[model samples]
Target chain A: MPKTLEIRKLHVEIEGREIIKGVDLTVSTGEIHAIMGPNGSGKSTLSYSILGHPDYAVTQGEVLFDGENVLDMKPDERAAKGLFLAFQYPVEVPGVTLASFLRTAVNSIRKKQARWGGQPLKEISAIEFYKRLEEKMNLLQMDPSFAQRYLNEGFSGGEKKRAEILQMAMLGPSIAILDETDSGLDIDALRIVSDGVNALYGPDVGLLVITHYQRILRYVQPQFVHVLVDGRIALSGGPELAEQLEEHGYDWVKDQLGESAVTRQNG
Target chain B: MANALNFNRREGYLEKYGFHDKNSYVYRTEKGVSSRIVEEISGLKGEPEWMRNFRLRSYGIFEKKSMPGWGADLSGLRFDDLYYYVKPSDKKGRNWDEVPEKVKLTFERLGIPEAERKYLAGVEAQYDSESVYSSLKGIWEKLGVIFCSTDEALKKYPDIVRQYFGTVIPPGDNKFAALNSAVWSGGSFIYVPAGVKVEIPLQAYFRINAESAGQFERTLIIAEPGSFVHYVEGCTAPVYSTNSLHSAVVEIVVKEGARVRYTSIQNWSDNVYNLVTKRAFAYKDATMEWLDGNLGSKVTMKYPSIYLMEKGARGEVLSIAYAGNGQHQDAGGKAVHIAPYTSSRIVSKSISKGTGRSSYRGLVHVRKGAHHVKSKVRCDALLLDDRARSDTYPVMEINEDEVDIGHEATVSKVGDEQLFYLTSRGLTEEEATAVIVSGFIEPIVKQLPMEYAIELNRLIELEMEGSVG
Candidate 1:
């Protein structure tokens, strides 16, 4: 089941600079949450912190992915636990093909689960896997030929995001974090990627969409919208908050919680 | 303790690669190379004007060159005691059954026959001085692709052989290159036609079947314009009471829009000195990739390198080495960007155990005119035992300001967490170590042709068997 991805007093530091400071948010199963803010508002850091990115260290706080603290786990471990972070800039692993990488990542999760005293896993053969992968690629509107290509190598902006969604579809993680996947996308590609995410969105999977604009939010409606400013949640409301923030800009939140006050709250 | 030690020792890649019995070589030259033997080898190989001239010219270069003062020390090399060229057997055989008993028995243990039956487009089995089996069947040979021994290439296709043999790596390039050129014998010579892509991999296996011998091989691979070829070399030397020398020179040329992947998995014995030189050149829009693995040997100095000669060209080197006991593997890569928009990468991984020493020495150079050139170099080393040593010396000569270059290296031991993760999965100490070691070298291993890759995995596992604490 898609348990709530709850962040409580979450503090994170990237390269010794405290980025995500005292942030609190909750998204239930079947709910879509969006975090929007300015350039240095720690939106991406929050997503990275929750997914246990090696750079973003959780100095003090807890991210509960299904009531279990994710800080103690490695990035791959968190990923295996159905915690997915669609990177703002997906890494390019040149030699590993998309198929082999996904297969290995999935199999690693299965193998890790086997190590965790979980039930044994039976992996599908390549023939069966290719059929399913082709379907997922079609669902994501990805060209089928990309399946054999190297993971994210020389991929366009839209294709990289689609590949990320394809990985999410294959892994079928419980909580999906899309970190600015909407950036550099033509509206058509934005719709296709958002639709792909929406198609993956069900009661069993929760969604956390971080964006610089509400363009993607228009396609995938969010039940919860939080304004992240200066590393903390400055404003929290329903999807209407996104519309309001988009219209008024983060200026409304900036007025209430200025720079000094924000740092003080962080401290 | 005796029973435990036996079990541990049986678990290493050493046994798989070291299964051959020691045999006394017919003859050996002095410790270092010289000019007289160059004439002797030319006379022995039976005589050709151009061939003899190349050797004599290369011998001149060798005489003029000095031993390299960097990387691994070659002070202990006894060139006269090394059999420069040893054809202990009669002639090159085309089948396994026809091969000499010693050569056949050696590869039988290394699983060459099985790999030939299953994977491999063609297998060139070279035991010490010459190939015992060189076979490329119907469509492959019909494709106008010449996949044969270097000696055969010199005799059969002299024009192609003389044209690009020393272009990428000339005899005067380095001391070892000159040495290899003077008395080079068994090695691969592949020429894929333009627009031809060899789907299956072509492999060459080199074995040091003699004690106190030297293997000087010159491999020339030319992937013509728009063509592609993946050539792999697997080597293993038998344990000898005395030291030996395995010096090789490999030159690969990737013509315009062509691609060439060269992979090597070398695990020589503890007494062998493996000093090899490998270099490749990539033209406009071409790509060259080198995947080299170094395991055994008392001391080794090898750098499988590439030169991006034209614009929009790319070069990459992924290398992994494991040094155990009295071994010292000094291996890395080099990349030179001569034209605009050239990209290159150098990744080196190594593990040192027992009293072994491993070092990653590399250079990445971008010429003044090379604009928009991108390069990244990463070297990581792991020490498995207390007395083990690992070092990295990387030199980046960047004359171009428009290029982007990044270099990072890490040196550490096997982490307790990684071992615990594998051990907790029900693997014993050796199994856990084997898994982690293979994973550490997975980047380079993945590039090998599947059969050789599996054999390499097995060989590494065998080598690490008794190594764990």
Candidate 2:
């Protein structure tokens, strides 16, 4: 069976205020799907809800990963099921070197996989880990010194994005959700980070690129593009849809969906 | 992930080190302190007449003094219901095989002998009120280095022992210091001759096996001119229902051009009140460093101090504290610059979980005529929950015009975003919090020895087991 993630009629609310109101999407291995929407259009909320953030309560909906309901799973459990989310703003954890953090994460996911009748991932030795980490860092164009620094601490915008992609490469997730990863980057940094993401794309992983603009889409092409308006996918089409939305803003989608779209978008 | 995600039911994590055996004491003093108890302790040791008179005078001062009015609350302490001294064995053993069976079993469980065989150049094990086992490597003995019990040192090297015993920390220093002066025993006394350096660390392990017992050990280390020595002390006590008291006075003297480093890790059980006074004096061109870690104890009030008494002297203190469930850790450092060109640095990290509280109370003083002195103090505290609390009280008194002083403090709660980031990477909530905490204290933990650094991290993880939801 192929790996897949299906979000059905997802309704999410944080602090009693519904943000993601009735959203549906599906992604499969070896496919790339981009969800484009304006700011506050629930794109990030959908991504966070998929990852099982405790604050984002699923009021009414179900999320399935590989045909199993992941709605009740914890964040780490969701991660163990080969689900990854690239946060818009990565958290800074001081005192923990990047090398140690990545090692723990890799070992944790390996343990989870071993429990599911998969081949046990042997604990990587320090030399092997350093070699692999160096290879990944080189591919991502990150400095070697980053392995000793605290995770995401005192990092620039481009460094953080590259670090996120570096983790994606190390974890080898089946499905990855990139939430507004292109928001805070210059053109040069945007190109480097997009290239790093593109390098990790293969037949074993599916990608869900969530962004408001089509800038990152130019570097890393998406197979399918969906216009998210009023917490719902109002229009869906090929990669040209992203260029159309970029040229004609979100007003075109709101116009096509009439008064209800405008009311829900503002609401 | 069977054992990987076993954070929810940490049934035996913290209690692994809390095992204790039945009390079997050879000699025990009556409850509380007085001139009679002091005289009895002095007479038992058969000390010199002047030493007996000194104890009597110190006892008078202790009787007149009062409990401190600041830091942790000690109002619940019952002085009348505690034994001042309890000897576990009749005599000190020069070898591990000669030690008593029960006491030897306790040390074996604590891994003292293993550690001694591995890296320590000298080892001293203090059970209750006296050193039960003590030994020094032959190489150090050939180098004119003296490592023995304080009582033995007072008898063999009386001139050197009496010269610097109370000079660094006088008997009238504070209430706990006065109490320690009157009835102190069992602590390590080390002396390094001029131009001699001990390569490996000297270790002392203190254990309180009896219930409601007070272990007052007095340690004095003297590094002669151009000498070097590193002394490490570790402490732990078995779990007891009733409270116990641990009041110690450690005085170190670093002579001209000498260097000394003192590292201590105190992990007394929650039923112990750890009130200690430790200070060092650095003469011209000398250096002193103190690495202190406080993980256990119901309430602890200890602030290691350094007095830079001459030009070109330096001092440093790196301290870390962890307070869990019903524990209060009030620990910090102090530095006083009394001469020109003296420098000092102090860094402190603390974590408070459950309903525990941690406070950093430090002082830095630059006395008059002390010119071109530089000092910096940094304190960081992490609270695991909303109920946990932390406080920082730093005082800087600079009386000179050409001195430089700096201080920085931060108190933070574990962020939800940080937890989410770590959990998203497949780490459990408890593991994520532990990672964050270890990172927070990495600056100070890195300064510890390899074995101790690992143990400190493990202890912090055990304390952080149920801290996350």
Per-residue lDDT tens digits of candidate 1, residues B128-191?
A: 2233333343557779888777877778998999898788888898877888888888788899
Q: Give the chain B TM-score achieved by candidate 2.
A: 0.87
TM-score of chain A of each: 0.93, 0.94
lDDT of every model, 2 decimals: 0.76, 0.82
Candidate 1 residue runs with Cα over 4 Å from true position: A1-267, B1-33, B91-136, B205-214, B235-243
Tell how far residue B394 is off in model 2, in angstroms.
Answer: 1.6
Error (Å) of candidate 2 at residue A248 is 2.3
lDDT of 2 by residue, A113-132 (tens): 77775786677778888899
Off by over 4 Å in 2: A115-122, A186-188, A259-267, B1-19, B90-136, B205-214, B235-243
Chain B TM (all candidates): 0.85, 0.87
Instruction: Return the interface RMSD of model 1.
Output: 8.5
lDDT of 2 at B106: 36
Model 1 earns a TM-score of 0.59
What tens-digit string does per-residue lDDT give for candidate 2 at B1-469? 3343433212343444332323435687888888899999898888998888888888888888988989998987887888776665533223544434544443343444454321121112433223332234566789998887788789999998888878888889998898889998778889999999988887664222221223788999999999999988874323232337889899999999999999998777677889999999999999999999997788999999999999999999988988888889999999999999999999999999888899999999999999999999999999998999999999999999999899999999998889988999999898899899999999888888777777677667755666678
Q: Which candidate should be chosen as best, given lDDT against the real structure?
A: 2
